[model samples]
Target: MTPAHHQARTDGPPHAPELRAAARRLGRRRFLTVTGAAAALAFSVNLPAAGTASAAELDAARLTDDPFTLGVASGDPQPGSVLLWTRLAPVPYQADSGLPAKRIDVSWELALDERFRRVVRRGRATAHPEFHHTVHVEVDHLAPGHVYHYRFRAGRYVSPTGRTRTAPAPHSRASELTFGVVSCQRYDQGHYTAYRHLAQEDVDVVLHLGDYLYEYAVNSSAGSRAYPEGTLPDLFDRETVTLEDYRLRYALYKSDPDLRAAHAAHPFVVTWDDHETENNYAGQTPENSVPPEEFLIRRAAAYRAYWENMPLRRPQLPDGADLRLYRRLHWGRLAQFDVLDTRQYRSNQAYGDGWQFPGPESEDPGRTMTGDAQERWLINGWHRSDALWNVVPQQVTFSQRFNSTSTPSKVSMDSWDGYPASRERMLAGAQAAGVENLMVLTGDVHVHYGFDIKRDFDDPGSRTLGTEIVTTSVTSGRDGSAKPANWETLMAANPHLRFYSGLRGYTTVSLGRELARADFKTVSHVTTEGAPLTTAASFVTEVGEQGLKPA
Candidate 1:
């Protein structure tokens, strides 16, 4: 799992830094002339020559006509800028996107009004064929704490208008910030009913902890009851492994009108878990026995597609397959999010996978979940952060989840319980740094869990270090039951667990200087469309309180 043993992928096309830079540097006057001509030249080279093509050939007009099929998304918001993203996939969910292999000019504009009458900034960027014709414009020099409307334009195609807002100024004493938390959106399991409601909420940002997409084959049968029968196409019935495969999978998920609407409505802070690459993959190791070399190649493809689709800034751009996804985003002085990449830098699951009693191997101090470098990075970030609330948005459960109440307690190997020493270090470091309001937002269990993180889980009266809020999946478990068979046993097994829910939905949090409140929103049904959302439970953590209290 260490970097020294793994060789980076050097087989992809060279980086087009010059084209990207030139596109960004074009003035308004030059943009009209140079970009138009560049678009024509790209068409000539990529598209079939006029009067010299078959009737079945892709229509060049289609590229310009409704090119923004996947929808627009904004992410990684800062004080002065936000990243805008869109892919020119007129014919999404197919190989090559039914377009030519040439770079196209994509124009974008930011306006102060929803009507776009008060335009503030306008620019053009190249949608490189190598990047699957995806455009990521890092719009900067914007007014802080201002809401802006944005859209993309190609030939005759105009994208849907998207709303985005910059963070408050760094020194501003922002009183409150609201955001929604979601994860584990398995397409076949259920519809994106949660996102439909999330889009309607009044929130600043949406934190997607992980499991954005599942890497499993669709199974719509009686015994298992995967996706509703014939919900997904036959092409996506198999698992995604290649770059093209991953790209198509994204198209499939993005094609959902509800999901697309959510992305277009608000900004998102996204990270991936095991399902994005492979089921329960840990570092360079795949869930099953696959060679390290082959697994790395697969990882590279998955990471590349992830960056292309997400609204990430240039620094997070993929270097082959080694993407720097673990970065921080600050909401002025109110809150600072230290996004973690737990899957990419973790030791293999201890004692194989599934629930297991914690043995000596699981307690090994050398066995790390965040690896050496990332663990240091996270701890250092925590120490240096001055924000009132320090939020760690990451994958996997941060607190212990025992399977039994007996002396020989069994825990999920996939969670932090397997890496006990690493988890302890993080908790102890936060305590040492005097972090008063350390909040952990988690995903990947497909169930909602609220836990009081303690220095000693074995002792019920141990000092509480922080609180962990684990949001439920968007649709991972289909329409889950209110009380699973082992619900009571689990509730009794872990005294630290404050709340638990089996329904599918998300969590909405409102952060203030005095306290933070989390609403555990649940959808009664996700198997069919139009599920009603309700607040299953609510909790609040006061400024000086180490754990959550019923709100």
Candidate 2:
């Protein structure tokens, strides 16, 4: 199968000057406050009024099927709070999610024990049809670095119990932190066997770097999994372009039992790549023939659906066509995770966004991967971080990836290799901030990669500034091989690259005070079900010393 990144064949012009100006203007505090409040108000209108005399409510006793088919999830954990999520979709994939056009009361509970003998927090949230009947409850006043069991209930229906954990106290010294990194799970391409295995791992949280659900059409037979005829609805037989289209697409993907199992197993911290909206889009610029104005509409729909479906707080909600997703999460004093959004605030790809030789245009200093505001934010975060490890969880490769051994090496325009100036600024910022243990976690390419982030890729003996671990896709490229076609060439051209593997799986990283160990896990196949998972490779980097060493 062709790599998903190769699918972006540029056939449209760059973003208009006015749109760029608008994006820049969005940085102003006044504009953001106005637009954000307006958007929130528009969304709030659908919610039932507090202390209303007579408001419509869904009768849980009248339901026949399970409303929690998509399962329960929790995310964005804090020392005192965690966001709980569940959508009441008895019959998922429907336009209204098999619910009437009204508000439904969903009660949720958090307990110290799995059996609910020690109930801690309980409250009710209104699931509005305007928001696809999804409930996002932000539970606060919880203990730090503690495990909790949570579930939701609507009428007589009860959701599956989900496990969640809060971050350690701000200044506490955490001994260790372990998380699973995963991305690029295309429902049509293969089965979600990776998620099934991930649910069993002893991970505290799961970081979804991007491409949670592809926008491609899924056949009625459901592509590689080959479900029985009529299993999937006809609504999913086309690309997602509208609000309803995106909503149904998510319903279809989340309906999978394995995917739901993973959500119920651990909390997820998510960020989107280009596929969440379109392939290789830059800022407001699209990849194909769609007009910029029309494309923004589609983008708005995609962003809204993404926020509604994920276990995110209200602050991350979208405002028209824009959503602020880049934020920081702290795991006590052990590590600080700066999750980034690369696709939203990036310059158009150099050389039409394809694999090409470097040039002045590609090396332009003005072109940015993370827009100016985000760049400053990241650098500032690093400067103020007091954790033992400063971890950057992002969507694309941070190190240079040479495709061939030729003099003029061809690199992916979609990655950091395309914007050398941007990469330079990032490295320089980290150095200036005196970051000791900088670890970048990436997921986009269908293959796993371990790179020693060098101060200068042109010089093999240059100082190893940091380490980057790229996880393989969940199931994007179908069943992959141990060595892809470019594996040897990449290894030969870039000595900084230490490990490479082509397989379907995720990566687990255990961060301690002195050492951070990364285990590259893989599965033999994904086109068919029941693929056994195994460890493909393991590498570790010391706290003060950078660079990967085989473990």
Candidate 3:
């Protein structure tokens, strides 16, 4: 479930013809804007090509301010390759990211040590103004299961050193794997204290489930952070709509020190839920008020900005409003992660899209949560998985969450509970594929939840199929309590729900051959900086077992 602001809208289904027509209009508009001479210069050098910038060609001396202010990041690691990212944002809030209307040469180095004395790979990539002067370098031909240090240099200025690691060899018998999970960090709700603590954890990688940044406006005071007046630009006070707006929003969010520290410390595998575009959006359908064609234009802008800002590879780049984000990652023989994109190909929420009672429309087998193609992809991936643990890093809760202990309990329409047929298909697929150790990692409700994914929700003694670990927000709800007001009722109503906590923090999981352990880490407060971190709870599920137990 999301915040109250994402109210349910009872809009009819979206018309495909109108959406296609609107996309053509938007494409023509973009073509006209990019036909100028400056646009030509920006695109000419923006090809995804690798080359070295000569010493004389480096513009470091001309950059008075550090162009690496947004910091460096890595993501989508493979056994022999990894993606490194950095934006030349001397003035991040500006439309051009404080760069001229041309391309700039950015050099990066991958070293065996942090001191750069033993450099392994070094290359140059051209950052074009068309892409907000951001660089995405895919460095390959590295050792498997090895740690590496990376940094970017544009002319004379160098970025902060970032730590990254490659996955273990595909057939290697890796003993254990540990990773952090986080989501829903609304910049205006609270401080990013959880991220500060996460930066210090000894995790291999971080899976950001969604809502990396909200689409809402930020005031001059910078929300709960209480910054001094005029700290944020006036442009951020409006909801993100255009490509420039989305890019600037990313700049402002990435400008935070704690968020930057987390990125520099570990690689992040990210996916979006809804706030990346609009709240409760279903497929190409808008929330309610906007027309389908108009919404498609906004969706295209948002998708392009998302690709430009994240540390994703070339294949993940958006073609209009579509991005192939659902993929699989392997960590030796220990775990296989199936990262999912639920927001992009979901059916419109039944009965408007908020909390609602179960009905025929919501239970239709044709209605999909991951669309037909992705659903088949997931099931097929599971059938071919040889790893011990089949872990799913997805956006929403996969278990049924009952809001009240009544005859007709209400469940979130935006979560899996609203699409029971989809959930059933996923569980059946896993069972058919003989997935013994199933684990689902989720984040979206802004509360920590541990549930036993039962084969049948209505039967308390039904067979447990897997375990779902729902991490709380990084800083969504300003300052949450140890137990929310509905704790007791929800606990009593849902017997499969093993644990629940209303705290602002994340969850760290350690996957091993014998068992998988999860630690719910929470911060004392998020309205102020330097909040003390604590472990709210711990649970574990053993290999070949499907339910969670106290660890």
The top-ranked prediction according to lDDT is 2
lDDT string, candidate 2, 1-551, tens digits: 01111122213222335444554667645544543343333333333333541236776777788899999899988998988999999989789888887677788999999899999999988786767888888888889989999999888889999999999999799999899999999998899999999999999999999999999999889889898999887889999988789999899889999999999999999999988888889887789876455576677778989999999887786766788999999998889999999988999999998899999999999999999999999999999999999999899999999889999889999999999999999999999999979999899898999999998989999999899999999999999998998888999999999999999999999999889999999999999999898999999999899899999
Q: RMSD to the native, candidate 2?
A: 7.1
- Give all candidate RMSDs, comma-separated: 10.3, 7.1, 7.4
- Name model 2 segments beyond 4 Å from true: 1-55
Model 2's alpha-carbon lDDT is 0.87
Tens-digit lDDT track of model 3 for 44-87: 23233234221223355688888999999999889999899999
lDDT of 1 by residue, 1-551 (tens): 01122232223332235334545687545543443343223212222222332113233345645788899999988999988999988788567886787667778999998889999999987776667888889898998998899999888788999999999988688899999999999887788889999999999999999888877776433113344676555777778988788988888889888888888889999999888899999986788876444566677778878988888887776654467789988888889899999998899999997899899999999999998888888889888888999999999999988877787888999899999999999988888788888899999988889999888988889988778999999998888977777789889999999999899999999999999999999999888788898999999988887788999
Note the clash tally of each candidate: 0, 0, 2
Q: Which ranges of candidate 1 are over 4 A from the true structure?
A: 1-64, 219-233
Query: Between candidates 1 and 3, which one is better according to TM-score?
Result: 3
Best by TM-score: 2
lDDT (C-alpha) at residue 215 in model 3: 88
Which pairs of residues have clashing backbones in candidate 1?
Answer: none
Model 2 Cα shift for residue 113 (angstroms): 1.2
Note the Cα lDDT for every prediction shown. Answer: 0.82, 0.87, 0.86
Give per-model TM-scores: 0.88, 0.92, 0.91
Better of 2 and 3 by TM-score: 2
What TM-score quantifies how close candidate 2 is to the native fold?
Answer: 0.92
